[model samples]
Target: MKLLFCVYLSVLFFSLFSCQNDKRVENENSLSIQREKSKLVVEYRILSNVKYLEDRNCIEKLASCKNPKAEVRFLFPKNISELGLDTAYQEDSYFIHQLGVFNKPIFNEDENYRIYVMTFDYMVSLVVFEDKRTKNRTFTITGKAKGIFWINSSYWIVGNDCHMGCSMSIERIKDPKLLKPTKEQNLDSLRKQLQRLPYEEKMKIVRQEGDELLFSANDTLYNGIGKKLSGFIPYQNSMILVFEQYKSNKYRFIQVNEDKSVEHIDSLVNGKFDTRQFSEDDMITILPKNQSLISLCQTIFKIENDTLFVYSLR
Candidate 1:
């Protein structure tokens, strides 16, 4: 009877502890959700559709078309027009895709700054555009880079070099003038360390060590969501990761907060959309002014027949 009483007491103690732990986790999750909901008050609106057509003379694809021509009828918001895009813009030699998507515009966290990749045959350059509302300045980085990421308040470039296989470099404002290039002393060691990190997806650096190395944010995101990560958008202190369901047309937009809490933001069902073709930055445009108001715009493009239709989701 004494041994039975001891076992019963032990079971009671374990059950109580387990319930308390469960409540703690539940409270934490509830707090995270409340915090997220307060800040992420997104207002959705649909803008007018803009259309573009392929040139009748060009026989090849738009990428190869040297003289790509399209009748451009762009209708954008006033803030987008503030970026110096003329609403009545018409194309003679270059199409809309050639200027925007083809060139590749990589936007930073706040969207105040952007880097445009300019490729001319064998030569490639990065054009950095800084918008201060009053004064807009542009600078150029003359080189080829496999990938460029705005990591830890600095632009890290994975340079493509055939000599040493490849190299890494950092560009930051040194004297408050312009972005200056800084070379790492130990390239081989840094490369080796980065290679050792267990990265399941490409270019999604979720983890970071010191000032240079970066790793995946969450391992569970890789295994739980899908085998492939479409892309991610960095918003404030959280990251909105996109993943397509396996063997399905559905896409999941997941938000991972700073406290490591995961939440599902939204989902999209489109058969023609493929994340592999474009980066998240390319697909979505977040303006700085609208972000402060908790009102931002998302643009989605669809091509039917030979005409391109651009839809704005605000």
Candidate 2:
């Protein structure tokens, strides 16, 4: 009887332990699936193709010129319409489109030549250029784009310059079912959360004659009307806000408002610039300081020299 009772108790104990383990495993699996489903999906398409210039010397000269370090470099004739693809160039703004893979020249001529390159993933064309004069001067302009795309899928399109440098913009191929918060929504939520704090806590964040609110990490209080916040700085505790504050006239003030509204409060030197709504994190702002231009995340703002900078405990 004693041996039978022992076996029954042991079995019951094991059964309960197994049930708990199974529940934990199931929860973990559910979380993993949710994470996977929330990821954004993107697709790319190319839209147009054409051959514009045909001069062999022009083509060889342009191609042989060292590729610019920047992405989306543009070389335009002083008289762009002289290139002869007047209609296409006009429609696409001097034939400026997204840059893509370049193929070796298929043919060359003294007056005209042809080289193949992918303008976008979808549109591949052979461009032909001819010069009437021996001095065929062209201007090259280059810039970069920064954005996000899907890892597993090709989200770039041809016909327009799409991906440049570290920047890539993606269009959704399929609706992303994830519930990510927008800037406004996140700001509102944070505001509500902050409102729930004691008035003393809120008062600690007030700065610049009560025009701005700040949250600090090291118990320092910063105050200014045009103070800047660092771009999209994530909080470490997931409860605190991490940002950079403006120090002088050289910076712009970026604020994540109580309502989750992000804006640029431009420097007084820039003529009392108001804040503009930005939806994404890829945007950057350039500020002209004394002699050099400083580039920083759009989240920071410049303030008056007299305003005191404050920091507070999160």
Candidate 3:
């Protein structure tokens, strides 16, 4: 009888302890969780497209249609009142995707600038806005796409034009290979386009390319315009490359000799090579501007479809 009584007491005590543990667990479960709101307000965002590239970013080929869009975004917080960024916005259209600040202010504004490459696909640019505000601003370069970015601190483009193809990977600017330009592919396309145009239009594009190849605001002649250039002059002296800023109605050719003296020929029409009426065909071959010198002081030129047989005497 004593043993049975002890056993019953132990069982009753153990049950009470188990009940208390269960009640403690229930109380903990009933407690509410404390939460804190995030203080980040996105200021703006940028987006772009990416395409598959090969041949060291030189040769371009369509890889069964695997091109996708990529993006670089700028995020700002809400607390800065003097900087009136009222909202953030994003939109996707058939050809482009637009991302920017939306007026729905959420978190405290931050002055710190952050850039993110938010997409996995190879990033490419359909078109880039020449934002004057960002022209002088410097950006710290980081992330997977190093030299792949189109814009520099001074707003110079250091990547492929995407005309031929762009390398999915890019080396740091310090590398010698950086900014070499996939010239064969890019220039070939440009050359073909220029050939179909009239003489005046061709000159215009050449000048435009000169401006595009500028390294900085003050650079003079780092342009790729000279790529198609060759020596000219049917006489003893070699003919130097010439140029004219393309306009709707007029153009000029510049020739230089060993002495660095400039000879501005007005038109390919024997004398007034640079100055011509808009109506004239100017069947001038502007590129491959070469002249053959058969003898000392005697050079031969096939000009304007042999309409002008130019000869030189020393």
Best by lDDT: 1
The candidate 3 region of ten consecutive residues with least summed lDDT is 278-287
Each model's C-alpha lDDT?
Answer: 0.33, 0.22, 0.21
Per-candidate TM equals: 0.34, 0.15, 0.17
Q: Please give the lDDT score for candidate 2.
A: 0.22
Span of 10 residues, lowest total lDDT, candidate 2: 286-295
Mind giving the per-residue lDDT tens digits that candidate 1 earns over 1-314? 99786565344322221222321233223213423431332222234332212221211134433544322212233344443334333112111223332343433333445433332111123334454452344433322333344433544332221111111122222121243221322323323343354433101221111112211222233344543444443455444444556667555555545444666653453442333322222222222222111111234332233222323432
Ranking by TM-score: 1, 3, 2
* Candidate 2: RMSD to truth: 26.9
Q: Model 1, stretches more than 4 Å misplaced?
A: 1-209, 212-223, 259-261, 266-275, 279-314
- For all candidates, what are the clash counts? 6, 48, 29
Give the lDDT of residue 205 in candidate 2.
29
Which parts of model 3 have CA positions greater than 4 angstroms off? 1-235, 240-242, 266-290, 293-314
